[model samples]
Target: MATSSDRHRIRFTVHYDGRSFHGWQVQPDQRTAQGELERVLAKLTNGPCAVIGSGRTDRGVHATGQVAAADVPLRWSPHALRRAMNALLPDDVWVADAEMAPPFFHPRYDATSRSYIYRLGLASEADSPFRAPWCWPLLRPVDLLAMERAAERIVGDHSFKAFAKAGQEERGDRCTVTEARWAPWEGIGLEFHVSANRFLHHMVRYLVGTLVDIGLGQREPEEMDRLLAGEEGLETSPPAPAEGLFLTAVTYPADAGTKPPRRRGPQLVP
Candidate 1:
């Protein structure tokens, strides 16, 4: 059980299905994961509390390893916290695990890398019903080779200004993408996985959208190279929808292994 003063900083691994919720961040008059999380934490602590997420995920974006941290005044055991939160939270969300962390540890700042996966699949009669929310349903067949070629062009450090969504808040559109690849998803669809130090708003979706165009033969794969070389006003396709995206994982230094509570599924708030 957590007692007052032993209620130290705790981290959480939260997962959600982005189809129903507005987004990960809390907003007024909207049902967000953060808002529901804070509500449960406040009830447990008997006071108001706030949690800081590793990053903001856009509306309709899912997360399998979304990290968040919060400070509580009571020292509640990880199991106890998980159980209590599960009892109070809705079925859409639940705590996966709970662990203590160093006082200096922060989920957002200490993260070294963040990875995301996007699913693109053609709608077929044999598709699984469970995967509908996580995979984009495309009516046309796509050229897997073209997508792979275009994906290679995005691997490496570069000023991604051409791919970034306009009006995103950032110093600039530069990002170091250490890994970017596309692969077939069990003969049903395509999957894109990318890892980066950080990402701008709608960056992955925009990139996926452009690559999908390449796969559809709407654009040549080599055009990606030109786009990376600071091409301006070349008219790219709109970004893919957010529903197919998921924050898959976040890596940190080994020393910062203070585990947070984990939630297996999305939690709905009343």
Candidate 2:
């Protein structure tokens, strides 16, 4: 067995189309982002290799800047390991960057914040098969002003028990949202960008759903304040579909480790 000193920790920035897997975590008899990476890594190392993601994304949730970490043999350089993994990983997944990390780096705990984007499709073309899988095709106009006002209500620390799925209350629901906004997305519709220190299960989706309702004039923007206050007798709108959500980025301290060099993109072997 290799001693602890023989291993080197590597951090990776990953992207994946979520349509093909259950989620990011491993599961019994089901495909997952972590499982696939571990499978390929174990083969390369000739033994078991554990991978830890910055956080879990639910089924059908995509990612363009997710972060993960693993300890590997010191012989494998960051660039070479990235190339090898991309060669073996499934078509839907790609490693955008990889680099050496501090010995005790933990993707989740070390993260300063995580960002997510939720796409809304309001144009007719959004109904096309090419676009439907990546965004919510509501096909209806929404009050952008109302949504904006409501999103502003999210820009502070608050208990998000109203937005998150059950079972996480014990972990504490307070999240310090650093940024939140809704903006145009190439004229197709609106896209919501939010960044926070941490997120609870389905919290972003629920927020999107309620915001959409507010945009449609079904509810007032002040409802966001009531929800954030954890007031009783008010239920949040149903969570938006998972397919429309994407994990966009994860930030960390400046001293976490050296940033990986810029690469053109992932190159896969045919």
Candidate 3:
């Protein structure tokens, strides 16, 4: 029978360079965030262990505050486990912090919201190798006001079907977005910050793509509203490059919560 003495749950705050991973979810023969964690954990425990993440980030999508949970043998305290994992983990994946969690903790289901940041390079300097991999180097000015207006339209509850990948309709596409805004990035570009109760596949990317079009004057800002309303024949713009997206944080209820860090200017990708 399972008992507290048998295994303990640990919550982990992780960061990773998405360029090196296939994605967050584990797949047969694919290198993924979860797969790496499980592999390391299995070696530590001398058996299989599963790691559950707050959500699945697509390929080439980075993360600074991704949360995950897993069960480890009772001998491995949170601190020791974290230290051990870091010692064995690869350079691109890191365990920023680890703590005790209730045995019932489930990162994905317990999360109250998730936040993402998408970076865009509006200047020629952004083309530098160091920055280009982390942002879309458009090398042109965009109408910030137009993008802001379009973002405002998504700041409340809405059916985001048009902005998501199809085939998940059974779960519905309604998302309650609490915040969405554009901010100046580290003097090189613009960044979009968005927080929501839930996100559908490619929702943020589609939103960014569509908003970028509006900012570029290729579409009207009002089109955001039309997409939310699911106007017939109206489709979202192509998804933005996955390289520019980052899973910034995940939030949960007060007792189980990990509040997001103070909002700041976008930081350089490590």
Candidate 1 whole-model C-alpha lDDT, 0 to 1 = 0.79
Which residue runs of candidate 1 sit more than 4 Å off their true CA positions?
Answer: 1-6, 123-129, 257-270
RMSD for each of the candidates: 5.6, 6.2, 6.8
Per-residue lDDT of 198 in model 3 = 96
Q: In candidate 2, residue 268 scores what lDDT?
A: 13
lDDT of each: 0.79, 0.89, 0.88
Error of 2 at 16 (Å): 0.8
- Window of ten residues with lowest summed lDDT in model 1: 261-270
- Estimate the overall C-alpha local distance difference test score of candidate 2: 0.89
lDDT of 2 by residue, 44-127 (tens): 878888888899999999999999988888899999999999999989999999998876666776689999999999999889
Best by lDDT: 2
* lDDT tens readout by residue for model 1, 128-193: 677766778885788888988999988888878777778864558788999999867777777899
Give the Å error, residue 45, model 3.
1.0
Predicted candidate 3, C-alpha RMSD: 6.8
Candidate 3 or 1, higher TM-score: 3
